[model samples]
Target: MRTHFIAIGGAAMHNLALALHEKGYNVTGSDDAIFEPSKSRLQAKGLLPAEMGWFPEKITKDIDAIILGMHAKADNPELLKAQELGLTIYSYPEFLYEQSKNKTRVVIGGSHGKTTITSMILHVMHYHNVEVDYMVGAQLEGFDTMVRLTEDADFIVLEGDEYLSSPTDRRPKFHLYQPNIALISGIAWDHINVFPTYENYVEQFEIFISKITNGGILVYNENDPEVKRIAETAANPIRKIPYHTPEYSVENGTTLLETPEGPMPIEVFGAHNLNNLAGAKWICQNMGIDEADFYEAIATFKGASKRLEKIAESSKNVAYKDFAHSPSKVAATTKAVKEQYPDRTLIACLELHTYSSLNAEFLRQYEGALDNADVAVVFYSPDAVKIKQLEEVTYEQIAKAFNREDLIIYTNPVEFKDYLFNLKPDSNGMALLLMSSGNYGGLNFDEVKKLV
Candidate 1:
């Protein structure tokens, strides 16, 4: 089959392009701008476009399929040309469903923890020599690519995201999966730009649950009230299984998970991660992995990239970086770090980079998110707000939204950088937590490592 990609430089799009290339499909792609990792990987696979911009001539009648990416706008030149030719255009998720329609699909969906849960399942399967095709959002240690497809594998594990499938497709990506087995870790209002209202955002998940194949299984988090309510009220015929955070204790910065056999030591920490582990265990069990084998394989699982990843550590101070821009993620991560090292003074810093985090109305959702830290700091660039076309958020608004009188706010990157570099640890050791989906305005992580 011959497949052409409209905007192929996105994280997920580039991986799918590479997977098709490896599968012996004649794959070609075009993008306006390609960033690192995606650029280098595509170039290595000989899938990178000859030039940067899209060429209408590339959309030929000979192409069998056009896989559209979310990065491409509706009026994108390649997309427009493809439509003009009346060629079949499939959103990434739609194309994935077409490829794996024959296999049993296990989709992990939630506002957070989906990546970690999916990664854990893959790790356990890989360890037990169970062959399966899979797609996860973040890069795992053993995985070569974020996506894989095969004709022989009987099951496919997908990290289902609730974001829009493509600019032309208004449906959420997970709605197209129609999974044979699904897991909803938790529901927190996100992607404010797309859904607009909290109720509207939640309705997408309800639709996703409705899309499950007949008599399929649904594994959900029982601890979250909203998730519990949704799972119980669902009218689908699928069997519902609820999971909570397993018994675990953090001892001297190492987390030991309680198992039926004994205490299993794991590299990952935090209550959210423990909860993710519990959900992954259920999915793995349904996929033919036993509880004993699941615990054995999960012991070696470090974590997904940028999810509370330790950047630098010393005897007195440690630094961690996390891809946590959402309100719930920030709160959970902050509390986890504080709990891990109770003797240390936790200094939590967050960068308001995403459209949701920058919105004036959405800012209030972060009330008391950083309360666990001994010192709370927030940083955001005014230029970022302008670039996103969002209303300007003032220092007072942020301070008031967080409802912390002692909040430290920085609108300038220079001042934030200086504050970080000059941080001095006192008699009580300090733990630094940096949370954001973006770099702190070009703040070099190398310099951050030196400080720790």
Candidate 2:
């Protein structure tokens, strides 16, 4: 197969390009600007575009397919040429579906926890030598590539995101999968730019549940009221399995899972992670992994990257970084860290980076998100707000929305860095958490290590 990609330097786009290239397909791609990791990875695989900008001439008649990435604009020249040639164009998820249509597609969907759950399932399958095609959002320890498409795998596990598919395809990416097996971890209002209203955002998940194949299975988190309600009301003719937070205890910083055999100590901690693990276990069982094997493999799984990842640790201070930008995720992460180290003084800093988090109207959702921490700090860049073309937000607006009079807020990166560096953590234990989809204006982690 000969495939060409428009805006292929994206995280998902680049990974898919590499996967197709690995599958022996002649792959070529173009992008206006490519950043680190994606830039270097594509270069290593010889898949990086020769020059940065799109060349309409590259869209030829002989090309078998064009995979579109969300990064490309609707009026991209290459896309126009592809359309002019009447060539088959597929969005990233559409192409994924085309490749795995013959196999059992297990899609994990939710506002959050989808990445961690999908990673856990893949990790267990790898541990048990269960060969399968897969696509997950985050980079895992054992996986070479985030995406794998094969001719012989009986199943394909997909990390189904509710975000838009592409510039041309406005439908949520997960809507195209039409899975034979699916899981919805939880639903919280997000992507305010696209959905506009909470009701509109939730309708996407309802559509996702309806897309599950006949006689399929849906594994959901029973503990989440919204997820449980959605799973029950759906009229799909599928067997529904409900999972809740499993029995566990955090002893001296190590989290132990209560298993039928005995207490199993695991590397990952937090109630949200444990809930995700339960959902992954149900999906793994449906994929042919027995209970004993699932627990055994999961015991060794660390976690997906950037989901409560420990970046710096010491006797006096421990710091973590996470990809949490929404209100629900922010609250869960803050509570998780504080619970794990009850004796420590938790100082949490959140970067309001994503469109939803930075919006003045959306600010109220985070009213008590950082309440678990002893001291809460929120950082956002006015330049970022301008870049996203959002309405300007003031310090008073943020402070009022969070409803915490004692909260510290920073709009300048330099001042934020100064506050972090000047912190005088005593010999008493202290936990520091940094949460955002983007860095706090490119804050240096090396300097963060000196907090102790």
Candidate 3:
């Protein structure tokens, strides 16, 4: 197949391009701008565009398909030319569905925990030497690319994100994957820019459930009232399996799970992670992995990148960076760290970077989210709000929204770094968690590590 991609330097887009290229397809792509990691990865694969900008001339009659990325505007010249040529164009999710139509698609979906669950499934499958094509959101330890497609693979694991498919395709990405087996971890309203209202945001997941094929299976978190309601009300002809926080105990900074293989210690800790593991285990069971095998394989699993990832640690201090932007994720991460180190003083810092988290109305949802932290700090860039075209937020507004009078807030990165450096490491063991979807404006982790 000959494929061309418009705005292909995106995280998922670049991975898809590489997957297609590796699948023996003649792949080419163009983007107006490409950033690090994506650029380097594409270059390494010889899939990077010769130049950075789109060219209408690149869309030719021989191109079999054009995969569109969310980053592309509707008026992109390459996209216009592809349309003019009457060539098949697909959003990233649409193309994925097309590629995996013959396979049993297992899509893991939720506002959060989707990546971790998907990664766990992939990790277990790899450990068992189960060959399957997959597409996960994060870079796993052994995976070459986030996406993999093959002609003979009978199964495909997809991290089902509820975000928009593309600028032109208004549908949520998860709705495109008509999974035979699906999982929804939890529901919390997000992507305020697209959904606008909480009700509107939830309707997307409902649509996702409806899209599942007949006789499909849905494994959802029973603890979340919203998810439970949706799973129960869905009229689709499918099996609904509800899971919750698994049986586990934390002792001496270690979490062990009670499984058929007896008690097994796992590197990843936290109630949310345990919940994710249970969901992954059920999905694996459906795929023919026994409880004992799942437990044995999962015991060796570390974690997905940036999800409570330990960056630096010492006797006195431990530092972690997490991709936690939503209120639920922030709360879960904070509580997890505190539970793991009950005697430690937890100093948590969260960055309000996502569109939903930056919204004035959504900010209130963060009330008591960071209450688990002994000292909580919130950071937001004024420039970020301006870039998002959101209502200006003041430190007082955030402080009031969180309902924590003692909360520390920073609008400047340098000052935040200065404050961190000035604090002496607690003698009684302290945990420092820096949570955000984005790096805190290029804050130097190595420098922070040295200071702490």
Best by lDDT: 1
Ranking by lDDT: 1, 2, 3
Q: Which stretches of candidate 2 lie over 4 Å from their true place?
A: none
Compose the digit string of candidate 2's lDDT tens values, residues 124-193: 9999999999999999998989999999999999999999998998999999999999999999999999
Q: Residue 330 error for model 2, in Å?
A: 0.7
Q: Candidate 3: list runs displaced more than 4 Å.
A: none
In order, candidate lDDTs are: 0.94, 0.94, 0.91
TM-score, one value per model: 0.99, 0.99, 0.98
Query: Ten residues in a row with the worst lDDT in model 3?
Result: 443-452
Writing each residue's lDDT as its tens digit, candidate 3 over 1-452 gives 99998988999999999999899999999998999899999999898888889899878999999999989999988889999999999999999999999999999999999999999999999999999999999899999999999999889999999988988999899999999999999999888888888899889899899989999999999989999999999998999999999888988788989876567789999999999999999999999999888988999999999988998888778888899989999999999999998888899999999888888888999999999999999989999999999899887789999999899999999898888888776678779999998867778777767754
List clashing residue pairs in candidate 2: none
Against the correct fold, how does model 2 do in TM-score?
0.99
RMSD of each: 0.9, 0.9, 1.0
Q: For model 1, give the RMSD to the true fold.
A: 0.9
The 10 consecutive residues of candidate 1 with the worst lDDT sum are: 443-452
